[model samples]
Target: MNHAIFEKNSLILLIGTLIVVSIGGIVEIAPLFMIQSTIEKVEGMRPYSPLELAGRDIYVREGCYNCHSQMIRSLRDEIERYGHYSLAAESMYDHPFQWGSKRTGPDLARVGGKYSNDWHVEHMRSPRAVVSASIMPGYPFLAQTPLKAEHIEEQMRTLRIVGVPYTDEQIENAQADLLAQVSPEAPGGAEMQKRYPNAVFADSPSKAGVTEEDALVAYLQHLGVSVDFKLYDDKANIR
Candidate 1:
């Protein structure tokens, strides 16, 4: 009865297609240009450290993104469950941005600091130990294998090329940030402070080399921190 409908290329279809495409493209890109203002407030958020940077390289090499995503969406269930909605600035440092397309497991953007180093080590060793039903493969090597610190500088350089900000001052003061994160009250506390007035220190350097566990921990800890269970308002600042 309506054979012509199958053959017809209606003008409405073209207009609708263009409208949908335009809206999607705008929604995808417009926020990028306007987000630096909000990102400025994430003072605690910083570039990954040398060893932790190396760990990140390992994370990428392992294709952790295959199962996990780093970006949390701006939805109610996501916010209520994961924490604050994912912010544009939180991910400004990610070169390609790991806001993965699917949630095979869960969003890792805020998985930083969700567990302890020992826990992460165990989870890497055996995901089932932590999550009874996790289909994740075990990374037991992360524990048995000591991380190589040799290429840390090269890694840092590579990140710099890719837009992760690491200042000469930060590099020089890296140890200070490392110390600050380790034991802020250690005997060398005064000395570290005196030396690195502007340096941000991390805690321990796991067997995974000199990667500051603290900085990595900081990055992890910051995930989902923006989640304030309270009602939302424009004035809300990320803690």
Candidate 2:
């Protein structure tokens, strides 16, 4: 039988399996090589600020992706509920994009600017405090724990090596920016603001030092805000 050939000849089976897998991989990956030039970009899209990047790391570390998805599907219902559908250009800088397929909580594609920082803080401390039916757990400790940002520059440097386009100045000032983002009147914040116009500078009432809460809120407030969907031309992406 055909099965007997593979079962008896281990070397032949190994070679045959590798050949099949290679062919399958080639079929899946070759199209991307051919289509790389066809990629389109929208305006106002920029790399995440240092604070937001740190928050994104915390988001991943806390397994927030388990409950929430960042991707909004093209379906009409999804678009209506979560603003415009997600754009490839929006996720271009993501080392591993967060376009997850789970929906234990709502999609977060357009959650930016939807609620105030205070509301987010309250929600984070206890979701049910604001949303009575919420099943999400509280992260009260986030506000108490100071953000560990001394190595932010090194993180930015590593991201640059992976094609994030972080400039030398950005990497050099990463730690400053992280601290500046949580203080509206911080002297160093002026440069950070200039570098990131969309970045929100909030004053944390409870803590003098920036905390994990501040970083995560910054990241949440930065999502789905890079580009103006009204100005976007959907046809340009079709190839």
Candidate 3:
């Protein structure tokens, strides 16, 4: 039998509706808190270094997420095309993860180490030049904009406050590490490597100094290449 009281009163309808919505929300979200295996235990997944973090910030500033996605779904087609499906552990340290919703560009989950740094520079400067059918707009100005790294340490400190695993020494050396990532011959390059073992340095293609383009490229090149898939059974992690 239907409850005539619920239909006859607005306040009763609002309360009943809120109860339904809250139950649905709890059903969806509550399991994550209780489930210990929600995120996989994987090896070789490290947090982003100071320079990579700077590049990630620049990526957000450029609104690259508007067109690109960093995640790869576990469907067979996605695995065939993008190498491996993305892991929750891979982005566990991201304050706001970059698993974008759209794919105007291909999924960037495993784009790291797939192309040379020089190719990335040319493609960013003129996307259509490298991929003739590409409709993406060019970002030539990124190469011209000198990287202002004066506040990089402050940025790292802010990220540390949010649980990004940045150490005191890492935050203190943020500026030098940023410069060292683009200038391998710089005096601090050796120290930077000791701090961030996978950091790669490449000269800016357009300007004399390290530019925003350098940071973005460095960030892109480090994507989806952290976890060593050889150590785990691919089938076990597929989700």
Best by TM-score: 2
Prediction 2 TM-score vs. true:
0.83
Please report the TM-score between candidate 1 and the true structure. 0.63
Better of 2 and 3 by TM-score: 2
Better structure of 2 and 3 per lDDT: 2
| CA lDDT, every model vs. true structure | 0.59, 0.85, 0.82
Q: Output the TM-score of candidate 3.
A: 0.82
Task: Order the numbered candidates by lDDT, best leading.
Answer: 2, 3, 1
How well does candidate 2 score on lDDT at residue 21?
Answer: 100
Give one digit per residue, the lDDT tens place, for model 1 in 111-226: 75567656665566688999999999886555445445555555567778877787776566554444444444544555544533322333443534333233334444444444
> On a 0 to 100 scale, what is the lDDT of residue 28 in model 2?
89
lDDT of 2 by residue, 47-114 (tens): 89999998999999999988899998777777767878788888888877887779989998788888
Write candidate 3's Cα lDDT for 1-239 as tens digits. Answer: 79898999989999999999999999999998888667787777766776678789889998888899988887878888887778889888887999999999999888888998999998999999899999899999988888777887877788778867778888888887788888666678889878877777765555478788898899998897778866653765555
RMSD of each: 6.5, 5.3, 4.1
Q: Report the lDDT of model 2 for residue 38.
A: 47
Residue-level lDDT for 37 in candidate 2: 49
Ten-residue stretch with the least lDDT total in model 3? 230-239
